[model samples]
Target: MDAAGLALVLATLRLSTPLGVAAMGELVGQRAGVLNIGIEGLMLVGAFGAFAVGVATGSVLLATGAAVGLGCLLAAIFAWFVLNQRADPIVTGTAVNLLALGGTGSAYRLLFPPERPIVSPPAVPDLVPGVGVFLLVAVLLVVAVAILLSRTRIGLEIRATGERAEAAHNEGIPVMRLRWACTLFGGACAGLAGAILVLWISQSFVEGMTAGRGFIALSLVLFGGYRPARIVAGALLFGGANALQFQLQAAGFEIPYALLLMTPYVLTLIVLALYAGRAHAPGDLARPFVART
Candidate 1:
């Protein structure tokens, strides 16, 4: 491939890294019968946590650790409310997003005063000559999740829970426990996704740096039919669209940049229109499991 082609490929991989990571997590949650839209919030706070830690400690590992812990922490709160309190997942997810937005914005202002220049944090060093380390991490994670969900006993139970919670419970599977574990795992993925975004892609915590990638990842869950390999493909497609937009703008395209910026979302809508109702989703997806007396 020519230099330009190689550059485009690298850019697409970089852009896809975070989306793929987060979507894998979402795929796990969905397979375990939980629908969490708060992934956006999780990613947002995760970005903040990574940025703060990287700035304070100058350690990429520490930053990523902080991001993952924060993501899991927030996901635990959301799960407690949804699974334990019987709250609506959609409403709870929305509230989580709103809270992250407000909290991150406030924290950013306090840490990065308007009078000072915004500085990008130290990035995690590249793993290869031309590719990003996080992209490699994402690929490994996708493979790991695929194996976990397809070739393990826990995988079987998770699938059973998503397919029929009542049956799984009657068969002695711990339905609520499985869901909680899946939710927490998903949150950790989102946290890692946030780390990839700030430490690798942007290298700074812009308020709302996630930029709807969480929603896009949610769509990828459906777009890929809730499969890890397909989710990674969907993420790559969306990432390519985003990269193409930037490339075109750099090449001085005459079209409005706003329209270019909408490429990924527009493609998402188009794909959904084409494939809606065709994918096989988990039977118990998005339905809270209430124990019967």
Candidate 2:
């Protein structure tokens, strides 16, 4: 590839890093029967948390930790309501997204008054040939999650819970606990994505900086048929679309700016329309598990 082409490829990888990680995380949760729609909120909270802590401590490490920790914490709350209280996952998840949006905006305004300027944190250094450390971490995580879900005993239990919760329970699996763990793990991945955005991609939080990427990741799970390798492919495709948009705009293409901006999402919708219903999903997806007497 030429220099310009190589640059675009690198940019695509960077853009896809967050989406890839988040999608894999959500894939794991869905495999365990936890449809976490609050992923957006968890990511928003993590971004703000990471930005706030990074600014205070001037430590990228602390910022990343805060993001992941906050993500898992929010996931725990979601798990409590959905798993223990039997709350509606859709309703609770939507509420969480709204809360994160409003809460993060308000907190940012309060902490950094109109008179003060927003400070950007240092970007995480590139650890690989062309990508940052977070991107490397995301790739490793994708590989690890893929292996865990496909090659391990816990993986079997998780898949079983999603496929047939009552059956898994009857066979002596802890359905509730497995769901909780998967949800929390998903939250951690979402949080890591947030940290990557704030600390590496954007270097700052702007309330809803996630820009619906969490939802896109959710769609990617479906687009990939809930498979790890396919999820990576979907993420890269989306990332390529984004990069193409940027390149087209940079090249002064005649397309309208709005149309260019909508490229990735438009592609996503088309793909989902084609494959969503046809693809095989877990039988027990989105259904809460209730034990029998």
Candidate 3:
């Protein structure tokens, strides 16, 4: 590829990293029959945590850990509601999104007011001078998740749980325990994704910085038909759409800025409209499991 083409490719990969990571986690949860729309909330909290910790300690490692920790905490709360209380996953997730939005905004204002915005928080160290460490991590996660879903006994049980939780439970699989584990895993992944966004991509935090990427990650799961390879491809497509607007503006294209900003979301809608119905979701997804006496 030429220089411009290479730059676009790199930017696409960088942009896709967060989505890919989050989507992989979501896939795992869905495979275990859990649906977490709270991924957006998890990511938002994670970004804020990473930013806050990074600013306080000036340590990227600490910030990343804080992000994951926060994500797990939030996900645990979510699991209690949906998994234990049998709340509606969609409604609970919407609540999570709202909570994160309001909570993060309030925290940001209280901690760093308009008079003093956050500046130069610690950044994730790169593996190579120009390439980010998380990018490699994202790629490895893809391979790992693919193998995890296809190769292991745990993978079979997870698939069985999603396909038929009752059957899996009857077969002696710990249905509730497995679901709990998957939900927490999803939360950790969402947090890591948030860390990548702040430490590697933005190097700063803003309220609602996730900007619907969580929802987009959900779509990516469906778009990829719940498969890892296809999900990575979808992430690349969305990432390319995101990068295209910047490239066009840089190249002095005459397109309106607002329209450029809409490219990724518009593509998301188009893809969903085209393929959502064709994709098969887990049979028991989003259904709260209640043990029968």
Candidate 4:
């Protein structure tokens, strides 16, 4: 392959890693009966947190830790509203998105005062050669998560909470606790995904940087039937489409840049149309789980 082709292939892997991680995380959350539409907001917080911490401390590891924490914080807040208070998941999720949008924008202003230069953080160090390592890691994470959700005791409780909270509650499964834990864990993963993308790959956390990646990941969860490996495939497919768009641009195709930007969304719509409803969601996705007296 030519240099550009090689670059495109490498870039594809890097771009897909974050989505894969985020999707896997969401798969876990949704499996446990929590629907977090605020992944976009959580991701943005993680991205910005990584950038800010990385720049201040000059430590990528610290940055990643901060990213995970921030993601969990956002997730915890969402859990409070949806799981505990019985708020509408979609409405609360949208609020999370708005919070992230404004918070990041405000953070930038504070970080870069009028006289200071706008500085991006140093790049995140790669664990192995090239971006392929992240892709490989994404694969491993999917497998690990699938095993956790399907094989372990804690996993069983998690599934129990989602599939039937009242029965699980009577069975002493601590349904609310399980939901909160899974939601927090999932959010942390989402945050780490965004952090890796911004600090290691994109090297910048510009406003609205996550764009619709969180939404895409959410859709992948539905399309993949909440299976970890299948979710990875869906993410890779979306990532592959994104990669191809750049390739088409480099190939001197006469398509408008705007059209290239639309490719991912178009694919999302297509996938939703063909694959949605085919995938089975947990028995109680948006239902308020209440313990029977």
TM-score for each predicted model, relative to the true structure: 0.97, 0.97, 0.97, 0.95
For model 1, how does the per-residue alpha-carbon lDDT over 143-224 read when each residue is reduced to its tens digit? 9999999999999999999999999999999999999999999999999999999999888888888989999999998989
Indicate the residue-level lDDT of 223 in model 2. 93
Root mean square deviation (Cα) for candidate 3: 1.1
Clashing pairs in 1: none
What's the residue-level lDDT of 85 in candidate 1?
91
Off by over 4 Å in 1: none
* Steric clash pairs (candidate 4): none
lDDT of model 3 at position 92: 93
Please report the candidate that would top lDDT against the real structure: 3
Stretches of model 2 off by over 4 angstroms after superposition: none
Relative to the true structure, candidate 3 reaches a TM of 0.97
Q: lDDT by residue for model 2 over 140-183, one digit each (tens)? A: 89889989999999999999999999999999999998999999
After aligning candidate 3 to the native by TM-score, how far in Å is the CA of 132 from where it should be?
0.6
Total clashes in model 3, counting residue pairs 3 or more apart in sequence or in different chains: 0
Which residue runs of candidate 3 sit more than 4 Å off their true CA positions?
A: none
> Best to worst by lDDT, what's the order?
3, 1, 2, 4
Residue 223 accuracy (lDDT) in model 4? 83
Better of 2 and 3 by lDDT: 3
